[model samples]
Target: MSSPLHTQPLAALRRQLLSRDISPADLLHSVEASIAQHDPAIGAYLQRDFPTALAEAHRADLSLPLGGIPIGIKDIINVKGQPLTCGSKMLAGKFISPYDATVITRLRAAGAIPFGKLNMDEFAMGSSTENSALQITRNPWDLTRVPGGSSGGSAAAVASGTAVATLGTDTGGSIRQPASFCGIVGLKPSYGRVSRYGCTAYASSLDQIGPMTRSVADAALLLQAIAGPDPADSTCRRDPVPDFSAALQGDIRGLRIGLPKEYFGDGIDPAVRAAVDRAITLLEAAGAELRPLSLPHSSSAIAAYYIIATAEASANLARFDGIRYGHRCDQPENLRDLYDRSRAEGFGPEVKRRIILGTYVLSSGYYDAYYRKAQKVRHLIRQDFAQAFAQVDVLLGPTCPTPAFKFGAHTSDPLQMYLADIYTIAANLAGLCGLSLPCGTTPPTAEAPALPIGLQWLAPPLGEATLLRAAAAAEQLLA
Candidate 1:
């Protein structure tokens, strides 16, 4: 029998824990059982800490907000004494976190248990989990297809019912694309909205840690637990966090939603387009006003994002040079050989490609031509959103251009792989909050199984209250 606890939403689980309807150990076991049955096939977790989690559950404070809840953390986020492989051979078994990330501390304080470290693309560098140097994570709905990445395992764990909710970091579309492909809710909160102190850096300026869950409400709860300033992370905003769960009243009457013309044009799959279009219609019928808007710089988002993101990634990833920590080459000829060989042996192809491209753009002679130009374009994209938001409460689009594709589909073509994030990248460039949720599903074909489609909602920075409210309303209609 399917365990009700395993599939229950975070809010329901919280209520159950608070009321003593279910003991914390019972809840943990339901998740443990689900993981045992499904994780081998899904490959969502890289390391499991059931003993530690079980102990935590036993002593959990039921009166706390997330009391007794079990959560799977992305391998990039550090948990004290846990292995943070980051889906790469570089840190596999060698790197152990000595402290908890700010989010982990917040979750623990709110009474949640960090059950395990989930997998991801190596260093969060790819669009699919296929790039992970460790293991492959498959879509729970169709095992042959890929779960999107670099947050693939995060979305997969939640979608497969192994965890009630999980955390994922978004640089470009890492969280949202995977959530779309896996048919779950993913939120990429505004940059600086959540602390990044303990989460391994990808593109520091672009990355924001957020929640992946079964419903918008759960996403809200997870976000609430993690959002706020961190003294360790200077970039994190000091703005007071609102009660996100209480904002999901599902009433969005007269809300203005913007439909971006650039997002609806060329390259979007017919199935995905149909699904998002249907969601727009449903929202309109529920009393939202739809207005056609133009984010003129949208076309340049991909180019600028890659240049800027990789430039930042090149800087952030330079720390793992086999000097102080991480993998060290055997019998190195000298320091130079150690740096070259260790990196060569440790990084996956995608990570290497990005590093090279990033280094090239940031090189002295090319900095002004490539990196600087991209930064200019990034500014324009943010301005486009500012102008659009002034006229509408939120912007709507498809989360991905197409549904989940089979493994190896885009691995050979890096540009094509990057394009998979076209619809979701602009939000990161603009430093705005974005969400992806299941709106509909495509029919099965001879070569491909039925896949889920996602509708993306974008809001102004710190506008998650409005975004979640509208998403909750549309979620009910979609249901």
Candidate 2:
């Protein structure tokens, strides 16, 4: 029999805690037990808070909505008194966050306990966790492969059951890709749907806070807690977040689901195509209509994305000089050396590469050619989505054209690796919401497991409630 803590659904989980059938302390212990067994092999957490988390868990109010569920916060986001290094060597020993980020404050108010800070790619710039300056977060199913990135560690934490849910930023494919690899549910809400006040910026326009969890319902529960406007972040949406958990009844009958033609072509793996086909059949069985759609400029998404995203990253990361804090190299002769070495010694290779590319693209003469052209292409991409959604309620595609690849598969060539995020970059560039959910796991009868496959579901800005209601139906039928 499964433990009461393990068997309970979100509602039952909360109920058991409220009735004292399972105390928050016992749940925290289970979390630690899970970590002690899984993390060494998985690299899920950047830092674990045992005594502190247990103490907080002890005081957890069962009446709270999240019910004292343990949460893993990606390290780039602030957690009071915990390290927010953003997973780089420069921030090796940095300590203490004096105040909570807006999202952090909200999570606490919802009665969730933060168990630890998870890892990520340096400065949230890469698609694979392999680029992490500190550690590589590997796939839970197959250690040889990556748990997609830059929110990799967060995905792995939830996949391995180290924490019930986690918070991550989706600047590009950061959250969804990793969630896809880990076989869980991840949502990158419409840009500005959640406040970015305490979250570190990757690309201001592209960055959004979101949840990565074991189920769509759990992700919905978290969105309810975190999705409201905050005075500290002017970018936040003023629209009220409807009761998402209540909205997930899973009736997708007659809903139009688009199958983007460009997303189903040559570069995709056979296994991935097969998995998405099965998912579509299941959605069809659920009474949804699946039709072919097109996003022609989709081919240019990576080229345009790198140009815009890196330009923003280069500017956002300039503040980490020696004088300001975070990380500082000792003994500088002048301000120039201080800035030069602090950044040189501080940033990882992938970060430096992006910063260099961004600087080159934005430099005086090239801006109009490379950067401006990319913007025009961005408009074309958004228009493509606008045209498609006019006929479809939700668009579907492969989250990644292939399953988790072996570590070091595309590390040597940046362009080759960027293709891994092709299916996802368009959503970020269009400033829309998208999700990735487990459709199937390969080698159905294998003793050890190969890797899992995912299906992508996308909708216009602020359509998560609708998108997830459709996904909830699929999840049940697929199971």
What's the lDDT of the predicted structure labeled candidate 2? Answer: 0.86
C-alpha positional error of residue 61 in candidate 1 after TM-score superposition, expressed in Å? 0.2
RMSD of 1: 0.9
lDDT to native, each model: 0.92, 0.86
Root-mean-square deviation of every model: 0.9, 1.7
Candidate 1: where are CA atoms >4 Å away?
1-3
lDDT of 1 by residue, 1-479 (tens): 65557588877777777788898999999999989989999999999888989999999999998899998999999999988899999999889999999999999998899988888999998888998999999999999989999999999999898988899999999999999999999999999999999999999889999999999999999899999989999999999999898889758789999999999999899999999989988888889999998999999999999999999988999999998779999999999999999999988888889999999999989999999999999999999999999999998999998999899999889999999999999999989999998999998888777899999999999999998998999899999
Tens-place lDDT per residue, model 2, 23-49, is: 888887887888887899999888877
The estimated TM-scores of all candidates read 0.99, 0.97
Cα lDDT for residue 256, model 1? Answer: 95
On the 0 to 100 scale, the lDDT of residue 441 in model 1 is: 93
Q: How displaced is residue 255 in candidate 1, in Å?
A: 0.3
Decoy 1 TM-score against native: 0.99
Find the 10 residues in a row with the least total lDDT in model 2.
Answer: 1-10
Off by over 4 Å in 2: 1-8, 444-448
User: Pairs clashing in candidate 2?
Assistant: none
Error of 2 at 370 (Å): 1.6
